[model samples]
Target: MQIKLRLMVALLGLLSVAATAAELPELIFPEGVGVNIHFVTEHTNDLDLIAAAGFKFVRMDFSWESTERKKGEYTWGDYEELTANLEKHGLRAIYILDYSNDLYEERVSSLHAITHEEQRGTASPQHPKSIAAYARWAAAAVEHFRGQHVIWEIWNEPNGYFWKPKPDVKQYLTLALAAAKAIRTQVPKAKIIGPATSGFDWPFMEEFLKSGVLEYLDAVSVHPYRDPGTPPETVTEDYKKLREMIGRLAPGGKKNLPIISGEWGYSSSTAGVLQEVQAQYLVRQQLVNMLNEVPLSIWYDWKNDGLDRGDNEHNFGTVTADLKPKPAYVAVKTLTHELSGYRILRRIEMDPKDYVLVCVNGSGGCKMVGWTTAKAHSVGVEMPFKSVHRITGMDGFGKGFTPKVKEGDLIFKVEQMPKYYAFE
Candidate 1:
């Protein structure tokens, strides 16, 4: 009954945010949006909220230490509830196999030992035995969730603090390869992706690539977090560089491994960016990742993890801990709904402050999303469409407007926040 209620709510959202068209497929990546959810001890409202936002995927980091705390003693309390709820609400999972257990350690005992920092640490195993144990645990997890088509990301931010002590390219590749083998051994068709680094750690990733980590990966994963003010389009160059690196350094199939922005987002308070600006960042970054051909992009967080809005870490959520919506939350729903079946045709020619990206579908129809990247504006844009409606964004919906062709160009007003312009 709860799932039914959730689906009804998700369907109703389409009435307000969706375009007039036939029933479309669920939004997947390269064109769709998804969110990272931390429901370990939180309510199931996160799942409901994700479905309501029209997101198709939910990424949850499955801690090895938490599940298999005492050698073989397995507990599936919080995880089961979370995964079951996600399935119920019609969202898929990207389960991250990460962190370390005391039972699996060879050298870094203190690093692998669970502590207050285990929640934030990525103390992965070092020894062959410990690595094999992790692989076994990962395989067990894959077996348990076999039918759900869950994507397994080897670890999170291995090049960053998650690795603890310091990042070691050899160690990360070893664990990743072992986990991949174990997952494959258990579920041959399972999808394994990784090198889930924090940022573009050139040395770490290049070494991994040169060492052939791609041999075990189905997709290349990254956490491309950046400054809040950076336009999403600007980062396509960074991804392009990563692709070039893969081609130059890795083997044949490795060169073509798909990139998945498995985790990337801006924090309202954490990054010192305004909540509204955070909302705009959401649209821009997701669009940028999609345009760059990153098949999947997952926003880091869905709601504030703690009550301290003043703290940067606690303020990443698009909603408050109480389930209240932030501007970022609404923006996610609006941006995703407006993105239905739209492929980025090309970036239109525009002025400094103004930016225009055109998207079109089959049947020769084209639409655009325009924004000033800086602030709201009344700049004239050469939109080829005769008419348009504001589908969604942080900005309020605009009244229907008609564009006039001036000098062989249809001109319309563009604003700071993006607005969808569908052609008649």
Candidate 2:
């Protein structure tokens, strides 16, 4: 009995010694954060809420038709409030130069959908004369908004229904080229970004690259939407795929292109996604993009459109329809606060169900964003962590929770929910 008791105690001591986090070296990089904001006009608190979320930039619409309703007649009423709010908040703007003007389109397509004056389809004119007319509006708008340092994206999802009457790559490229030239001519210091396709439309992107439309633009942008129920970290592979595509498709043979995930988001109330799950994925998506070195990852939306929780379209926003923040808002706010100044060092691959993102800051201390692949499971980590602190991945605001720990072994209850662990 004594021999057996001694062996059990010895085994327990060995297990504890193997459980702590290993101290890792710092790996350095720089990353930026941004989000897509909607309904700034309707909600008085939208801009302030966005600013409070720690977003450094916003992707907002500067609709063309609304600005120049009459020929050569400029009205700045719609934009004055927006620019004022942006300047007040110190958040940069990526203003989309979008859609069709009634004066320029000889024949309007009924298939086009307009969401609050944001003409989403068949925005470019078919007539050559109308192209020149639209160019004037493009130039005038850029000139008016000059010195605000707002980025101009020629069109939104031009390769999808956002173009309308079936996406015409040739005509869309012509429209983009004309707009790019006009903006450069009118506002020399303005930054232009585009080919804002709905997803990876290979043919559409190829046309732009082969036609040298890339040379006229500042950054290549895409809305890399994933399938429902797919992991948000799936973007890491997608990002790699995009770099490969740009290297192969870009002009001058393998030219390095600055890629921007200008718009990306997952809808809650879709599939079996819980509200809490939505919040978890929101943080994961942004961190995945950041760790992969994508300069900007704009969450597709800022607020829910209505009070229907079951409606996926309305539930995409971080805030509820009433502008009350959801769990996602808090999760994002926390992520941006902690990871904003830090850079991802590497991705630690363990089993098929466990994933880890290694990160470091200016101080050389390291932190990790880790989550389980399948469902929840407890895992033991053995490493050289001097001191380890635990924060609940989704809701770590003011409360600090206890995680299972031993002498050299720390046990974490890993789940689909991402948890941040510190090793310094």
Candidate 3:
């Protein structure tokens, strides 16, 4: 009996030692990471809340129709308030000068008034001329905003719903190039990101790159959204395809241009999928994004729209209509906290359900590996470990939580829909 007890203690000690020697993965800023704030006009109250949640940047749309109601006259009222609020909350803005104005169109009194049919890319006779004029005017606006906002995206999802005729890559590029050149001429220091394709796999991106417009822009932007319940491994593949496409477009693989997943999120409230499943997928996607090294990723919007937009849109927000953080929001907060100071050393190829993130502390240079297991799974990390810290989320498995440890590696038995894991 004494021998058995001694063996059990020895086993426990071995497990503890293994956990301690495990290496923690470093969390590095791959590029420009941020969040998207649609419906800013309504969610202005949530700015402080968003910042408090640890988001570094906010991307807002400067709707053309909203800014310029009358012909040739411009207004900055909405933008002024929004930009000021963002600055107050310590967040940067990626302003999107979007859609067509009423005057720019022949019949529509305002942009909101335009039917989906009238507003699409079927430019009237005055379309090209109006676009060019709008470009020049937009340049002035960029100069006016100046230091308050630097990154400008030409439009939102021109290849998808925004495109009237449906996927007119050439026409969209024409307008985009014209606008980009005008903006550059006015705000020389400003960085311009374009296409802002609805999905990472836009049909026109490769063609546009070959056309030399890429030379005029600073970064490429994409909006890649899969169902929230999808696995992170799937999302990581999507990002890989995106990066590869960009590489193919650049000359001699020398493309130094940055890439931004300007819009990405899954809707949890959508029909057929459970809310918890949606939250889990959202968490996983963000982790995949971090590991893949995409610079900036913005969740679609802040507050939930009253209508779920076919149920999918309703599930995408970090907060509900009342500004309460959802499971997904908590997951992101936990991830940001875990990754706050470390840099990503390398992402290891474990099973799809199990992955290891390697990181080293910035100050002490102690390396650690955070082993995150989603579902019931196991994987191997190259590093030896001395200890293990099992961190669990507050509201249960996937709601987000931090691991507390003095000095050691981490072995996380992650359940479905959890946000992420970190190594110290």
Per-model TM-score on C-alpha atoms: 0.83, 0.83, 0.78
> Number of clashes in model 2?
13
Better of 1 and 3 by TM-score: 1
Q: Model 2 TM-score?
A: 0.83
Query: What is the C-alpha local distance difference test score of each model?
Result: 0.71, 0.69, 0.61
* Tens digit per residue, CA lDDT, model 2, 144-249: 8887767788889877666656578888888888878887888776677888888777777877877766666666888988766787877777668777777777
What lDDT tens digits, residue by residue, belong to model 3 across residues 56-75? 77888777777777766788
Alpha-carbon shift of residue 236 in model 2 (angstroms): 2.8
Per-residue lDDT of 101 in model 1? 87
Candidate 2 vs candidate 3: the TM-score winner is 2
lDDT of 3 at 165: 37
Candidates ranked by TM-score: 2, 1, 3
Error of 1 at 142 (Å): 1.3
